[model samples]
Target: MSGPHAPAQREHGPLPFALPRVTATQRRRAAALLAALEAHYPDAHCELEYRNPHELLVATILSAQATDVGVNKATPALFAAFPTPADYAASSPEQIEAYIRSIGLFRNKARAIHAAMKDIAEKFGGRVPRTMDELLTLRGVARKTANVVLGNAFGINVGFVVDTHVERLAKRFGLAPADATVAMTERWLMALFPRDRWCDVSHMLIWHGRRACKARLPACADHPVCRGFGSTCELRISARASDTDRTKSNQKPGSASRAAKRR
Candidate 1:
C-alpha cells in the first residue's frame, strides 16, 4: 500500500516524477489493500435501500446532489404512491414534486424522474434497462446512475462510478493524479482494481470517505491507509496529535490521566 511511484534521484537528490512500473508485487499489495478495506466495511452495501431494480433506479435518480438519508426519508412515501415505472409515468410532475420537494433540485428531478419513467415503461417494457447503452437512453440516467444500477442490481461492472467522494479520495490517496478528471479517474481505478471488486469497492470507499476520511478534515491519524499516501494527510496527523497533546495538558489532572490511559 505504498505510493504507486517513487521519487527519482537527480542532481537535487530526489525528484517526484519517477513512477515505478506496475509490477506483480505492487498489484498484490493493491489487492491486499482491497481486501483490508473489504474486511473493514463488510456491510458496505448500497445505502439507497430498494426492493427491486425499478425502486433502486428511482432512488438513485432522487439521490443526485442529495444525501442518501434524505433521499431515503422521502422515498418511502414516494415509492408507495408510485410503486412502478408505469405508476411514475402515469403521474404528473406536480404530484411528484410535492412529495420530494425537500431534496435539492426537486422540480427538475421530478420532471426527469417522470420523463425517465415514461421512457422506461414505453421503450423498455416497464423494467429498468440492464445494459449501459440501454440505461443511458433514459433522460436522467448518466454513467454514474447506470453504473450503480448495473453493478448493484444486475451484477455488471461495465464502468466505474466516480462520484464526488470517489474523485476527492482518489486524488488524495494518489490512486489518480490530483488533476485527473472524473472520467480519467474512473479509468485509472478500473485499471488498478479487479472488475469483480468494483461494486463493493465503490460503496466501501464512499462509506469510508464520508465516515472516516472527510473532505475538509479527514481523520487520517486514525486511518490505517493514511500513512500509505498523501503529504497533506501526514501533516494533518501530526497537527492533530499536537493538538490533542495541547488539549490534554490543559485538562484537569484526573481527566488528563483518564484521557492518557484511554489513548
Candidate 2:
C-alpha cells in the first residue's frame, strides 16, 4: 500500500494487520480512553530512576531486555561509580560492567554506555543532547530512548515511546494495527492524541499496562476504559477460553465418564 493512508511496512514485508480508518467517533472514543487512563493514574510518570538525562539514557538502554526495577537496583551503584558523562567516558567496559552486572546483557550494555558517553563527552560537550537527531547519533539510542530522554529530561515531546506494554495496549484498545511495529504504533499514537498530551499519554498507558493490562492476564473487567468500550475485553476472554480448553484437553480421557458413573 502506498498513499496518505498506506500502512507502514517492515523491511521483510507488510505488517500482518491493517489499522482501521480513523473517524470522528473513533477519535471521541480514543479521547475518552485517554481521559479515563489519566484519571486512573493521576500520578503517572516515568518509572525508571534517573537523576539526569545521561542516567535516563543509560537506564533506558539497559532496559532493552530488563525490567525497570532491575535497572533501578543496578543504577545507584553504577551512578555513584560514574557520576558524570565524563566519568563514564573515562571508564573501561570492564569497570562499567562491574557496576551493572546484575542487569541483563550487562556486558553489551556497558559497552553501549561507554560508547554513548564517549560521544557525549567528545561530540556534545559532556552533556546529553536535547534533540532527537543528536541523541540518535549516540550508540544504542533509538526513537524510544530519545523520546524517553527528550520528554522526561528535556520536556520536549518529539514522539511517543512504544515499549512492549505500549505496543500491546495500543492494539488491545484498537488504537493501532494489531501487527504494527513499534515505530508504526508510535506514529499511530501521535496521530490519535494531541501533541501536548503525547508525553502523558505514554506514561498513562505504561502505568495502566503495569497495573491492569498485564501481558498474560489483563484486569479489564475492572478497568474503566475497558468497561466503557462495551466489549467483553477480547484479549482476556480469548485467553480464558484458551486456558479452559487446554485444561479440558489435559484431563484423563475417561475421567468424566468415570465421574458420571460414580454419581
Candidate 3:
C-alpha cells in the first residue's frame, strides 16, 4: 500500500494525460459509458454480503486476492463465531485463522482482522470509523478497502473502488491508459463520473467486467456498449485477435488432424 492518501502506482511510468486536464469529449464519452453500464446492470452493487460495517470491512480485507464468492463462503462461519469487534479482539489470531483459512493469505489476513478489530474495540469504541483518515488507520485498510467500506456500508462516495475488474474495464473502455495504476484509474474515474455516482460507477464497471468484458474471452462481439464503441474498443479488437491466434494455433497440422479423428 502507498501513503494513505496517495494513489498506488505500478512500476510503469506516469499516466499519459494528467487527470485534472481531462477534455470535454472524454467526459461526454465517460458519461455515455456510465449510462450504458447502468442500463446493463440496473442493480449493480457490491457483491460482498455483509450485514453491517464491521462485516463489510472484514470481508473487503479478505477479498484482497480472493474472489467475492470465496470470501462469502468463509464469512458466514467466521462472522457467526465472532459477531462483534470486541469478540474478534478477544480471540487469538490462530483462532480467527481457523475460520478463514480457506481464504488466500489467511495468516496475514487473520493478523490484520484481529489487529483491526482490537483497534476498533479499544480505539473507536467498538464501531468502524466513518472517515477516510480514520479508516486508513485500521490494519489492511487501504484506500480501496476504505472506499468499499465507506461507499457500500455508509453511503459515502469518497472515491472509486479500483479492484482488478474495475481497472481492466476502465482500460478497455479507454477511460484510462492500459498501464495506469489502480490509484490513477480511480482518479480518472472520479474526475470522469459524477460525485454522487462514484460508488455506483465502480459497481457498474465491475459488473460489466464480470458479466461481459471479462479478462479473457470477453463477450465483445455481442456486448451492447462494447459493440457501440465498435473498432474503438481496444478490448474487443484484442479479443478478436486472440481468438484468431487461438484458431490458427489449433489448426496446426497434427493438432487439427488429431482433434478431427477424436471428434
- The Cα local distance difference test for each model comes to 0.77, 0.80, 0.82
Q: Which RMSD does model 1 reach against the true structure?
A: 11.6
Residue-wise C-alpha lDDT for candidate 2, range 1-263, written one tens digit per residue: 00112122112223234443578887898899888887888877888887777888898999998999999899899989999999988889899999888888889988999999999999999889977778999998988988877777766767878898889888888888778888788878877887667777888888888888778677877777767764345556978999999978988999878888999
- Count clashing residue pairs per candidate: 0, 0, 0
Candidate with best lDDT? 3
Compose the digit string of candidate 3's lDDT tens values, residues 95-179. 9999998999999999999999999999999999978889999999999999888777767766778988888877877888878
Q: How many backbone clashes does candidate 1 have?
A: 0
Write the residue-wise lDDT of candidate 1 on 1-263 in tens digits: 00111111112122222333455764776677677677778777678877788888888999999999999899889989998999989999999999999999999999999999999999999998877778888988998999888777777766777899888777777777788888878877777777677777788789878887787777866777655545255675678999999987888869867877999
lDDT-based ranking, best first? 3, 2, 1
After superposition, the stretches of candidate 3 with alpha carbons farther than 4 Å from their true spots are 1-19, 230-263
Clashing pairs in 3: none
Reference-based TM-score of each model: 0.79, 0.82, 0.82
Cα error, candidate 3, residue 152 (Å): 0.6
Worst 10 residues of 2 by lDDT: 1-10
Write down the TM-score for model 1.
0.79
